[model samples]
Target: MIAAEQVRAFRGMTRAGTRSVLIYRGDLFTGAVTLVIQVVLAIAVWRIVYSGRPPVNGVDGTTAVAYAAIAVCLQSALLPWQFSSLPMRIRTGQIATDLTRPLGLMWQALGQNLGVLLARLPLGAIGLAAAGLLGALLLPPGLSALLLAVIATVAGAMIAMLCNLIVSMVAFWTLEISGPLIVYRFGSSFLSGSLIPLWFMPDWLRASIEWLPFQAQVYTPVSIYLGQTRGAEAVALVGVQLLWLVVLTLLLQAVWARARHKVVVQGG
Candidate 1:
């Protein structure tokens, strides 16, 4: 059982993080617009691809549109960059002060990112609504699927946040994290099936990527949304997400232990 004080602290951090996101509402709108544009382009391409084919690999143009719509709508949360502050904190010596705080850095970071994600919810809803209006999106097949998709998405978001936190922790070892960040973003985009559904990938490649954590970030939830995963299969996919959540949580603890000890304040 969680202690009351811990719950309060988590709520407090979440509120602080939410306020930070609220402070940047303008940027959030800009991101939403960009997603709208990307969704349109993606829809056009899929339509053309399906113009001459019948549900190529079991995904039709209409289904593809719905997939892209929800995928992009939730992309903000699925691929949140709010925790990028850790590297900046390290560079400016803010992490030293952070280290002195009573709360653990991991919880603090998680709370802030959770707040940021909450702030993005309204914009994401608006995007989805607009997409639905334009026929670029479709409702989930049933209430049960929708509920399962949501659960999977929440788990996926946790996985994403933890992965980013792990990446940001690299700041403890090096001043430059650009290379690692780029590689991670690229890999996550491709492997997570945000750029292309894993269903369409070669069987061997898809099977390999499915075993990795990135797939839990975008593919699983989107697959659930598309109704490609249902019943026991849906449960298994969510199970995989939970498994990664545990594995990543443990990995983060190990990484933070070593990273905290090696922290070097660079500037005043």
Candidate 2:
């Protein structure tokens, strides 16, 4: 039961979030530079791995390189290093401010994230273009594949946002979340196949990741775009993304319910 007033409030918060991020041109510049560096390094590593070598396990050098470029770019866009603000607010006794808002605390946070996401979208596009210029990116096999990839990418971003939101709530109890945030960021990156495609993983490792939400984050859409996954399997992967979306949403609600009453402020 969403009211129109809340929708308007969310929109206003989103705009504020976007303006806050966009006003910092230096941050955008730094992010773009970092994304470029990452793509370059990823391309270099894969090229060296496959230099003078035939396709390993049905994946050629070109395909592998392309995967790395796209994966890195998407990872940069979708998983930009953002810490949970909840921890900082709790530590500074600012959680009280958010608690007084007319909009629910979680909804306000989500609105802010949605705005940040809008701002970051162009960064991802720029990375893709850079990959194209470097000869590391490839178009999807066909229009249908491209469309499906788009859908999966959106779902992936939402899945990722929900996962982060849930994790960020841990600050409510711990009061300091830096350690957990760092661990979760890198752990999710690897598990999400944003660094290495699951195609390259051992069978057992792949089997385990298949059931986790991380795979749906970066791997599924990119793999579909590469056409390495097609037909029913591709559809199945997107289905899994939707399933994870629902599951993570429920899990986030459960976490937030507990966190609301557990706020721990420091230096009060």
Candidate 3:
């Protein structure tokens, strides 16, 4: 019953053509632009860093280009900004009605996000494939690696959603959440290997970040695709993501219960 309501909410959002098209178009444009930038950046980075070297740390120019392209596609496709709106919804009290729904508000939010993701996946794939071909990057391995990458990416998204929910829930206790959200976004991009790969970071910093949840959001899945980590390590990384997901979900539930009691639904 509750699941059905969640599904209905998701369908409603997806079926709303204006909203759906807006999201799809915006993400498509962003993805396309990002691919262009990534290609250029890849060439620059490779030229500067490799300096005619065959490979640095076993990663050649082709591999480096491929990694950059993949990283860009992942970053754009993931659309971290989607979570930024949560605090706004909370601040404006739009979350009150959401809280009153039969289904859990977080689950409904998750469904809506998933719908946007579904709408963007095909376009994102096309952008990624085109960029890969242009950059001469190796294709994502066979069926097994592709399947693993998909599973890992989904898990990464779940972790991202959980983190966003946690941060957004802060509006329940404070009126000013913008500062914290900004910090979170910055940290996610830098520490998650979205802006810079972990491989390039100092050993101590990389080790430190491994313990943080941001790595699970972007680095883990990309590493899996690049074969940086495999087998048990890959499994362990996914496990860590799930662990954080559960913890964040529980925390959100507790916060929502408190927030719901204080909700003052405005205007209809």
Candidate 4:
């Protein structure tokens, strides 16, 4: 059974998150506008790549658009804007107060982050759906494929949060994490196939990247969504995601414990 104090802590965290959302009203609008620009850019790229050829690597214009649209949507939904702020909080001793709360600090952070994602889901979905429709002839995934994609995407988001937490914990030791965090974000974007589909890459390169944790972020779910993997292959990919999630979660827990021990409350 859940403790009442934990419940109250979660509620407090949720309220703080809701207030933060209200404060950043512009982000909601800006995020929507950004989604539009991304879709247009994706469409443009699709046209350029398929200008002469009817299809690229067995993927036609429709499949390309769907692929791009879903990629944009997933990135928007999963990317955390507070990765940088986390280190700052730790450095400033703000995390000290957070740690004092009844709930686990990392769990509270995850709840707040999830709240933000939930807030953006409606707009993100609408923007992606509209873009998909406008692009026309999107390749439709079967119901089972869609279900698996959803599961993978959720797992991917959890993995991303764990990674951010682990990276942010560096503030306890290094006092600066921005450089490493930026590198991590760039590496994830490129290696995870967020910038380009893994299917478009050469077989050997794809095989090597598939084993990396970055693929859990973007490529795995997108592959499922695009119907690029199915049946046993899809199951295997999801298993990989779950395995990574567990590993990352445990790793982050260890880091959080060490960081908490090293935390120096500058004031109070």
Candidate 5:
């Protein structure tokens, strides 16, 4: 339902975000190397944990390793180190100009994050390729699952971006969010099932994580890819993601309203 002009403006913003990442191709290379190393280590850890043992709670070593690799790659692309640039803009007062733009500030930021995701995908693919080369990666069981995983992955990326925006908007109040940001980064890495697949966790832990939006970010997509969650279950998981998308979108809007108000009050 977006207008043509709005779509065009969004495309330009997305390209600007893409260009920002590509401008430092060297960083992408370095990031790829780092991603590869991290994925390799993750693969090793999972393999070692399941070494010569039976599948833990219906999760085989291959599935675990594949999940780790895919999760790491998703973490890299979907969850950037600096998830949002809003905090910096807040410090520089550029957020004021951003608010006055034709496009919504949140929409504009989402476009930029999407652009970064596009640019970083190559790095993720490299890490995936390395994992495959090392014989630790596995593709989805079928095209249907693969398609659903793609859908789930897109939803997950949006959820993560919204969460990042929520964090970034904290700067509007405190003007310093490093501590919270670091906590959120690690917390998300663990809770999103990127550090380890949800299957590897205890039943109680898995149940608890299912209630959180983080699992929809990495766990759901990778689990779908591994065919761990199939058919109706897979669809339901995507449904859960859509649910979080709605919840988080509303939350972000509420936060953005307050942030905008704070900016206006202080500027006056």
Candidate 6:
């Protein structure tokens, strides 16, 4: 277990990062507006698609809209833009300073990314509220579901961070990470049900992606939020998320060790 002091220090870093985002909130205004527009457009299309149908793949129009709204709001948190520059930092040798910090490098990175999410929460909540007011989204089913969704969403975010960390660490070996980054971003966004519900996908494809961590990142949390997952199934989903967390954490540690050794040997 991490000692109290270590946890406190990590929290301090998180708060500092959060403050940085707040200070420069204007820089993200355009992106936030774009997200809102996308949410509106997605709801509009789904509305037309489900107009006459009672349900498409077990999701009715109302549930579909709610899912889309929540997914968009959480998208920034799940796949933060801040982390996209990690590979660039690696290439520019800024990672050397990061390594020299007293905190564990992985913790610092995760804390900072999470801070970005925290900073975005207020605006995200407003966007969701606006969508709800405009009849494009549904309120969460119940308090219990909302609480459970919060937990699930946090787990999802952690999974996303770990995956991104692993991807960014590749920069230690190769300067060109664009190709891999593109593949990862698209694959995760599509397969994770951030753009569309996994239930709407073909059976074969859905079944295949279900085993991957990408689905656990968005679909599971959204489903829980919508009350589509509960009881034992909800427990199982959280268990699967925990399992992946352990696996990814171990993989990251091993990779970071190799990366640090490479950096040191190269006179970084």
**Pick by lDDT: which candidate is best?**
5
Candidate 4 residue lDDT tens string, 78-133: 66455335567766768777778778978787767666666667666866776866
Worst 10 residues of 1 by lDDT: 259-268
TM-score of each: 0.92, 0.94, 0.82, 0.88, 0.96, 0.91
Sorted on TM-score, best first, the list reads 5, 2, 1, 6, 4, 3
Please state the error at residue 51 of candidate 4 in Å. 1.8
Model 3, 78-176: lDDT tens digits are 554554445666777777677677766666666666655565566557656676556545656566666777788988877776777678778767857
Model 3: residues with Cα > 4 Å off, grouped in runs: 1-3, 13-31, 261-268
> Ten consecutive residues with minimal summed lDDT in candidate 5?
78-87
Which stretches of candidate 1 lie above 4 Å from their native place?
A: 264-268
Q: Candidate 1 on 1-268: residue-level lDDT in tens?
A: 3477778888898998788877887887887787777767777777777787788777788898778767777775656555456788777778778777667888888887787778778777877777777788767789999999989999999998889889888878886798889888878888888888888899999989988999888889988977988899999999999999999999999998888668633332
Over 4 Å off in model 6, which ranges? 1-5
Tens digits of per-residue lDDT for model 5 on 1-268? 4588899989998998899899987887889889989988988888898899998788888888888888898899888887667788888888878888889988898888788889888998999899998898887899999999999999998899888888888999999899999999999999999887787688899899889999999999999989999999999999999999999989999998888899888892
The collision pairs in model 6 are none
The digit string of per-residue lDDT tens for model 2 on 1-268 reads 5598888989987887677678999999999888888888899999999999999989999999999999888777666677235567767888788888789888887777778788888888888888888899877899999999999999998888888888878877787787888898899999999888998999999999998999998999999999999989999999999999899888988887777656542323
**Model 1 residue 262 CA deviation in Å:** 0.7
Q: Cα deviation in Å at residue 122, candidate 1?
A: 2.3
Error of 4 at 129 (Å): 3.5
* Clash pairs, model 1 backbone: none
| Angstrom error at residue 75, model 4 | 0.5
How far does residue 34 in candidate 1 sit from its true spot (Å)? Answer: 1.3
- List where candidate 2 sits over 4 angstroms from the true fold: 264-268
Residue-wise C-alpha lDDT for candidate 6, range 202-240, written one tens digit per residue: 889988988899988999999998988887898788889
Q: After superposition, how far is residue 181 of candidate 3 from its true place, in Å?
A: 2.9
* Clash count of each predicted structure: 0, 0, 0, 0, 0, 0
